[model samples]
Target: MDCDSKTFTYIWEVNLDEFDRVSNLYSPPFSSWNGSVEEPWQLQFYPHGKMSIASSCLALFIVHRKLHHVEMDYTLMLINQKDENETLSVDKHSTFENSEDGFGPGPCIDDDRLDSPPSEGIYDPDRGFLVDGKIKIGVRIPTDPIPIKRKVDNMVSFTWDLSLDRYKAVPNEEDLLSPKFQTINNGEKNTWQIQVYPNGVVPELEGFLSLFLVHRGKDAITTQFEISLVNQDPTKSYRYTMEDTFSHDLNGWGEREVIGRRYLTNNTGFVFGDNVRFEVRIPLDDVSINKLEKEQAIVPFVWEVPLADMTSPTGEYLLSPKFMTWNSDESDTWQIQLFPNGIKSEKKQFVAAYLVHRGVKKVDTSFSLFISNQNEENTETVTMENVKFKYDLHGWGANAMVKRSDLEDPEKGFLFDGKKIKIGVQLATDHIPLKKTDSVMVPYTWEVKVEDLKLGTGKYLLSPNITTWNGQNKETWQVQLYPNGLSTEDNKQVSLFIAHRGDNEVTSRWSVSVVNKDPKKTESRTGTNLFGYDLQGWGSRTFIQGSKLRDESEGFIFDGKVKIGVELPSDNITLSIDNECPVIKEAPACEKCPAVVDSPVTKATPAGNPYDSPRPSPAGNPYGSPRPSPAPINASLHNLYRELKLKTPDGSEFSINHIMSFESIEKLISNLMRLSGSSSNYQPSISSYKHID
Candidate 1:
């Protein structure tokens, strides 16, 4: 009826036979009938429930059992004004004719009423029942007889009442019972439309038709499908059978959208507890009828976590042990502390000793700490924050602990006194480990408290340049030369030598001397003009000159071409050469000076040391070649000027005398005999005047 698509609603029933020679007939329109007794054919005109007395009692009980062999019994009815709700009723409103006096066809019939007479006035209304009002006996029924009725024109209908609106269920076939389903944690899907609807529409079914999904209750779950066909007719070829038979053809559900994934567990839940109930079992080997002929049923989706909130499971967030350190201070090294109401692990009780000596112990100790919230005017010496701790001492003794591997070189002074007690000692072996030594403007004696002597006394200066250089020593240039006084109120610390005979980058360009001695001309600016030697090339900007006693400031610290020298000075000794070149003085030990060649407590005259014989052979071996007139031996000379003791731009006192002179040996033989002319008019004049004698 209009279950929406086509037409296939049916229900039929038939049962009735009681003599009249219809002989156990209940169909084929009463398989022949008859009533005997010489044509006593008025079975009282039966038409009780109509249909022409149910086809005239199926034609007079098949002509009274084919002329009285006596076996008539019948029942038949039909209705089809397009299935007029399929109405057919029989039970006891029927027809039968058996005769031989067991006369059985009652109701609207030939009843030999052994106490029955409900209707006998049809006048002549029944040859048996009817013969032509057209409702012959075609049995079709079902229009609500309380066989549990609730509207049955059937193309789809079933209800045991669970009210519907589910989250999963629905799968069925044939007879169209289907409504069993599943999908909990998701599975066993398909059926948004496997539509085999000649009587269900959905692309309106055509060729094959086979659908199923059994397991009406207790846990049945099986589904394996892969068929696609959303539309139809592409030269049609639909096949499909899940778990077995080989069907699966599908042409249309292509551009993808029917949905289906399959595979279920927990046996598909219905019972096995947790209150499950998910059904769906379409296994006609999954499905066929040419894969649902013109296809349309699909269902598959999974992603569920709501079994009513299920409960319990989560994790992540760790951080253990990190870093730690400690050594003595008892209680197993103070266990681990950060203190001030947050870290502190407790257990330590006491330990703060120190004083281990391996030789001559004099580490000079002191300890008294305090930092309980220090706040000296918001103190800051460039973000000054100190409190680093890490002191480990384990010097077992016997001197293996010398530089025992730089015990954490903070320039070797190790300390930690924020305080919980730490008195000190292990340091001396030539100390040098006091860092940052407190400051408020400095009066450093290295920690001697009383609010640190209230600060202020810091001026410090001790710079004497040249830290080291020995490219083949050269007696480090006669062992001495001094002068490093440029401040600290000039306490004049002198021992200088920026000497250099060029090596190592040209002896770093030496020359720097001092001892200007002209203090208002008391005379002694000996050779080599008043100091100056600054020659820093390779890019300019550096110059100063007082003509050579050498103090050339490219920031003076060169050690080349030998200069700064001074080792004691009294009676008379001054040889200041700052470099105008030629000035190599050695004189000053007079009284005929020449016997002190090497002495530091003697032993250096070798090569036949007879006192190194020089003047001895110079007396008679005047012929030992080259002694033409030797007599001036110990001359005592002076006049080696080279001055400039400052003040001279009209401020008087800036002498520049003879500047250089050194000839003796009788004025070097009287200027070599007046250049060898002995001029009295050219020599021999004594002989030419012999007559006057």
Candidate 2:
């Protein structure tokens, strides 16, 4: 290979910002050639410090080998150098411009001690200035040295937006001498150190590189180093205690390293200092290298801060290596940004009381809607009264008086449906009520039915605070049975009897039962009305005090006669008896009535029997005045009329007859006679009767 013949050539040049701005702009070349093409092309510089040079022919030849066209770009930067020390003058437009005002280098560099500008120097690129090689500029050749295989005419000399050439690296080799960082704990100094290293074979390249370190959890603590040196400088270092907060920048250098300590205010026992590290190399000062591959470093060493170490007033929290894990299942590490425990709240409704009717107007029921915890083991019922309308309502009496009337019977309304009322609960002992954020409402359906109304339309919503009364008073009725001097196979077959008129036969049957002296029970049966009055049976007859007891035996019959009359303006009554007792006439006069007669006497006032006639009394009364009849038949008759049973849909028996014992018949009839007078206020539709058994 003719090393002298292979001159430095200009490869493609692009703006650093433009390279980043248009990364996916042009498509990759369709093909590249390895045949007859030199690898590892050379780079050169002009004598002037502002301009640089490279092998334009070599770049063109390789590009022509693979591509049909090529373009050139360049950058004009103020470069200063003294011996090997060089500084690029950036933002130097002020130096390039004539000061309109009296001041020169306007705000070029401030008086701040930390921001002083570097010392100025000069270089002439035309004086054999070389870049990584000897650039034989202005060399004569048999063939054109600057390749003409492609258009180089419209190429810019250099502009505000400039691009610099790139020397493509030889194939089959990686840029192994990449800048990288490693953290080291120097136990001798009891201090943490960050070391920069060149990983590949050519780690000693002369260029620029930067080392950056940021406090992982604490943004305040950070540091950086920008080295324009050839390789890592072990002497250049940064240190901080656990109490301080910081961050920094990397100037320019290749293969750099960075490390920072756990920031502290007063370094007490500061161990395992907290920090993250990153390093990158700068191959060129042009915008392309400054951008496209510039700062090409992994954002590695994210401090895996442990959640357990997250505490208040944190001075130093060294994360355990074993505790490093991702925030989510897929992510490698949790982001350190502040995350909020998202708190949310919602409103829940509760009802308190229902409106009840008084005559016509609605009044608040004294009853309170009771809420009992479903988990009764842990909680109890809570009763609330005076539940007014929600505060949002303007008026005071709105909820106090008004309730949504049930649709079924708006006339007599009901409020809430029967469910939905729930009690709020708190854990017992140290138990805290579930926070609003921690709890949720459980949906429930409520239903209500009103008694006096038709079904299907009377339902309403029952809020947690409101409930309906479920219990009610039971409807009741009663009946009484009498043994009526009759016997069945067991004992006396009590006669089935009804006294109260409105009582249903079925309900009355359940109310009363007949038991003999032995207290054993017996069933009642239906019977006929013997006297065609209150008492009804073949063996027992019913009669008023004034009505004659009639005989029923067929052959041995007796014709009886009796007359009853009430005294004027009083309940006193007199009875005149004229009986035809044939048996008494033929029985030898009955020997002074045998004291208390036991034998079967004539059931009637027999004809022509002198003993059967009422004799004149010295007391002036055969029957007592209706002495405020304890068993007033007329009052019962009135009750019977009012209490008369209306027929129910289902078949059941009922009666309107006034019921009493035979012994009370006299008093009952007299009371009835008094009640029938003009002064009597008891006016019943049913005729009064003296019940006899």
Worst 10 residues of 1 by lDDT: 535-544
lDDT tens per residue, model 1, 17-83: 2222222333221111111011122122232322433422322221221112323223333333334
- On residues 1-693, what C-alpha lDDT tens digit does candidate 2 reach at each position? 111232222222222232322212211222111121111111222221211112111111111111112222212122222222332212211111110111111111132121111211121233212232222111111112321233322211110100000001111112212222222112111111222221222334212112222222222321222221111212111211111223323212222321111121123221111212222221121222122112222221112222233332212212111101111111111111211111111101111122111011111111122223233342222333443322111111111111112211223222113322221211111112111210111111111111211111111111111111112312111111122211121022122222221222211111111211221111111111111222111111111110111112211112221111111110122111122211112133333211111111111110111111111101111122101101112333432331133221223324323333333443443465465463344432223432221
What TM-score would you give candidate 2 relative to the actual structure? 0.12
Model 2, which residues run further than 4 Å from truth? Answer: 1-6, 11-342, 347-693
The whole-model lDDT of each prediction reads 0.21, 0.19
What lDDT, from 0 to 1, does candidate 1 have? 0.21
TM-scores for all predictions? 0.12, 0.12
Query: Candidate 2: how large is its RMSD?
Result: 47.6
